[model samples]
Target: MAQSHRFWNWIARRYARMPIRDQASYREKLDRTQAVLQSDWDVLEFGCGTGTTALEHAPHVAEIRGIDSAPKMIEICRERAAAAGCANASFDLAAIDRLDQPDSSLDAVLGMSILHLVDDRDAVIANVFRMLRPGGAFISSTICLEGQARLFRQVILPIGNFLGVLPRIHAFSRTNLIAAFEAAGYEIEENWQPDEDPMKAVFVIARKPA
Candidate 1:
């Protein structure tokens, strides 16, 4: 985790400068997410790299706290928030498991392009479930490699990681992701794959039962 943090910190600026692959589709996802957010709600976003998504949704909520393990990422996030004049959004350097918020305190939790990188998906989901108020939402976009050829995902991705060509990936199927949410006591409000590409990114909006 330390090594990962250092790497991300070193690349924070470059990562921020990179262009979104599908701007139109990404905008659509943001719009859909913002549409469901309430102005009085308090939101938390884990693995919020550079705080882009949180900043985007900041205007729709009363407060948004974006957390990332990388200090430089959080620094960049703060810089961006300042540039955007987003008073309601803040960034912190913290791990998901280390979050100290009270149980049932948040109105929503968000994770975008992050679920697939976590080492313990179930534990993370459980924590997120614990943090939300009843009827709160867990909104996310996850990159799933489960649709790829088993040999390539299982063997090639590992080799790529060893070669430093790719970051370690925790391949998850869309079905399993939804099941994980349900197992954590969330009701699936929406779930769908946004792209037909082999990377298989999935968007999900799940609500805790009131």
Candidate 2:
């Protein structure tokens, strides 16, 4: 995990300048996520790289605390937030499991393009569930590597990770991903694929029962 953090730090500048490949799909996700947010709600976003999503949703919520394990990522995030004059948005360097929030304290939690990178998806989901207030939402977008080319998943991805070119990747299916949330006691409010790619991007909005 330390090495992974360092790797992200080394690439932070380049990562921040990388363009969004699918703007339309990203906009749709932002719109859907914003729809469930209230101006009085407090939100948390894990793996919030460069703080783009958090800043985007800042105006819709009372406050947003975005965290990433990578210190440099959090640094860039904080810089962006300051540049944008987003008083309600803040960034911190921390892992998901290390968040120092009380249980049932947050009004919402966001995870975008993060689920597939973590080693323990269930633990992350459980933490998110523990943090949210009843009726709060977990809005996320994930790259499901299940549909990726067999050679890439079985060969290239592992090689890339070994070479420090990529972080860990977990392959997950849409059905099982939804099942994980349901098993964690969240009711699926919405789930869909935003783009038609071999390795698809999935968006979900799940609510904790009130």
Clashing pairs in 1: none
Task: Give me the candidate number with maximum TM-score.
Answer: 2
Query: Which regions in candidate 2 have their CA more than 4 angstroms from the true location?
Result: 1-3, 195-198
For residue 13, model 1's alpha carbon misses the true position, in angstroms, by 1.2
Q: Whole-model lDDT for model 1 versus the true structure?
A: 0.87
Task: Evaluate residue 110 in candidate 2 and report its C-alpha lDDT on the 0 to 100 scale.
Answer: 93
Question: TM-score of predicted model 1?
Answer: 0.93
Candidate 2: residue 49 lDDT (0-100): 89
Error of 2 at 46 (Å): 0.5
Worst 10 residues of 2 by lDDT: 192-201
Tell me the whole-model lDDT of each prediction, alpha carbons only.
Answer: 0.87, 0.88
- Output the number of the lDDT-best candidate: 2
TM-score of each: 0.93, 0.96
The candidate 1 region of ten consecutive residues with least summed lDDT is 1-10
Clashes of 1: 0
Candidate 1: residue 25 Cα off by (Å):
1.9
lDDT of 2 by residue, 142-196 (tens): 8877766779889988887887877778897888899999999999999888545
Write model 1 residue lDDT over 55-142, tens digit each, in one string.
Answer: 8899899999999998989999999999999899989888898779899999999999888888888899999999999989999999
> Alpha carbon lDDT of residue 103, candidate 2?
94
